[model samples]
Target: MKGVDLLDLKKIVVFLPGRLLPADCRETKFHVSATVGFIHIVAAHDYLGILDKLRVPDDVRLYFEYRELVLPQLREAGVVVEEPDIMVAFLSEMDLPEPGSIEKLRAFVQDVGGFDLSYIMRDLQSHIVNPERSTDYYRIMEEFARVPRSIWREFKRRLVVSLEASKAGTPRRPFRFAFPMTDCTFMVASMDPDWPVIGEDGIRMRTNAVELFTQAAKYDLKTRIGVGLLISKVGDHFLLDWCLIDEPWSANAKLEDLLSTPLFGPARERVVDSYHFRGDNAEPGT
Candidate 1:
């Protein structure tokens, strides 16, 4: 399905946080005349694994239990209730090169388009000015100037490898929302909590985000589900960002806020019907 047009699908499944629907509803399915969200091309293994993991009755129940039980404890202890450090798990599992190993760093740098000091500095500047900028920005900048370029590049590459490994590794408790549809259950996996839906300016979507999702669609199509994207203004063009796929717990609230925006007014009209199902205990509502 090369160049698969999202409009071609007669019916599409939209996975939304269950909290958005009626309290008693456990499953729902409906139709929309126009696209409701960004079309992201995700790997089958990634998404299907989430679906399979979620469908297990024990896992599903345990997920809710963990949210209620462990998350608050973590928050009380000043630990963020987000995805675990799968990278640390990867490091434990494999004998990867140390961050200070220059030989391994050189190979990694070449593999990742090589090191460009100018580009790195520009990226650092962008981060420093970002509204949600990192607190360690000043320290990082100070260290960048003090350290040799090669050493700095090596450290950055190590972070990149760690992040990539984290993504590939299975989360001890994956973040996801399940919508048990009539025919099948559709799952929406959460992206990193740190990812900004809008740019630092607060209105536009980040250019890198647009490029990432668009490029992701080009690979495998077997696991491809229909696309649902959020439109954001980028310079003169409106770009797409994956929707309802942000942090699972807050996605519904985010979607609600987005729909109220002037840019999303058209999407509201296109959403024809929304249904809520309560298994066989009650009638589904439209």
Candidate 2:
């Protein structure tokens, strides 16, 4: 597999495990990235598992309540994780004017030279509402703003111990996937094998179902892929609400079977072969 591209790596770390590492660790070992990946997986699993229990046979209030309760914990975890990465990045990349310079710290936060504390806090705030629309947001923001320096102090202590262990040549385990499996699934689904054609009136229109998979030369090399999209229609426009992409094996066997049915099977074959209908302006049949 290709090494996880830097943009994707940054995207993965930005809110969750990304918040955990120091900014300086951007070039850390793939194993460290893998540990972050595992943390992300575990967090997702915990969130989803709780969501299932709170679902309670379609109680929407419980769902929102769950969100309100859990959002803070996740946000705090991200904030804590981000501090170390920011501290490391700052130490390695920039020159500090003074040991306790408030001006420099303010400039760093404002310019987003490192940690991105403001962005993370804003993102966390966006998920929950005050309902009565009072000063809760400001209060929470104030609470978080007061702690970075202290957080960094403790983090530095831990980092020293970690670095000492590293110097002693501790064996590191390898991770199987370069990027998360979900990332691979989404990337594969986003690949477009065909471009749009222009109509006589000069509007560009799509002519086929978007191709989702490509055949490999060897059978063993072929990837089994499946994706399900939940789309909503509002007025004259269609909006994609959610997407789930995964391998078409075991738990997703039903999805795999759905793709292999006569309707989709022929459409997929036509796409792979670049087959065009007989009529000049023919649209594909449903």
Candidate 3:
């Protein structure tokens, strides 16, 4: 950021506010901002957490120092693209009106696309859809009508694929469309509402990560559970970036069937290896 121009950095941040899955953005609305202070802080975190996580394979460790740090640093320095009002409008369209309300948040989780809305119908059903000769069955259905069982089943398939991918060198890339992993052209995430988005001209930003995590879990890929993703280029060399965010739960948390994947480990090395990803270009990878 020392050598980078502030104008360029702002552009990068405005372009890629990673769509948050539901649980992550719950109660939170997308708020676009371009305060210099905020940008500086975010860049620091990238230097600390994200950069530290990248593993320069023993073979390329020495040779890749420049590209590894310079490119990201440039993006980090130039992340102030959009104004705050635009973000407010974006949040309005998404139905996320400020934070702190569960009802509005739940409706948003159901309406949104990707993983956020996918699991709502299913999760709600699991809690209520019972044939027991009881009255609570109806009450449960009335109360928890967010996740549908069918969507959960689809999410289960993805979970299975992720588990299998963990065993294989290539983890099955997650996307909303039916495109192959190698065809994807974009990679993004969100931690706080103020996170940035990415582009060639600007540094990529993470938008509404809390919802992203929720959506990831609803779909069963559990990106938030512990997996940081890497996006590479091969077929056409389009979007060759990736993301690895925070871990799910904690070490002390008990293992459950919902979180049975192999996407977590020594951060840097894992992202480096996974970074070999080549988006299918026709699909979306996040």
Candidate 3: what lDDT? 0.28
Clashes of 1: 6
Top candidate on lDDT is 1
Candidates' C-alpha lDDT: 0.29, 0.27, 0.28
TM-score of candidate 3 on Cα atoms, chains taken together: 0.16
lDDT of 2 by residue, 124-239 (tens): 33322221433444543433332333222232333333333334433221101111222221111111213222343211111112112211101112234322111122234322
| TM-scores of the models, in the order given | 0.19, 0.19, 0.16
Q: What is the lDDT of residue 138 in candidate 1?
A: 48
Question: Lowest summed lDDT over 10 consecutive residues: which window, candidate 1?
Answer: 264-273
Name the 10 consecutive residues with the lowest summed lDDT in model 3: 268-277
Which sequence of candidate numbers ranks them by lDDT, best first? 1, 3, 2
Model 1, runs deviating above 4 Å:
1-117, 129-139, 162-286
> Candidate 1 vs candidate 3: which has greater lDDT?
1
lDDT value for model 2: 0.27
Name the candidate, 2 or 3, with the larger TM-score value.
2
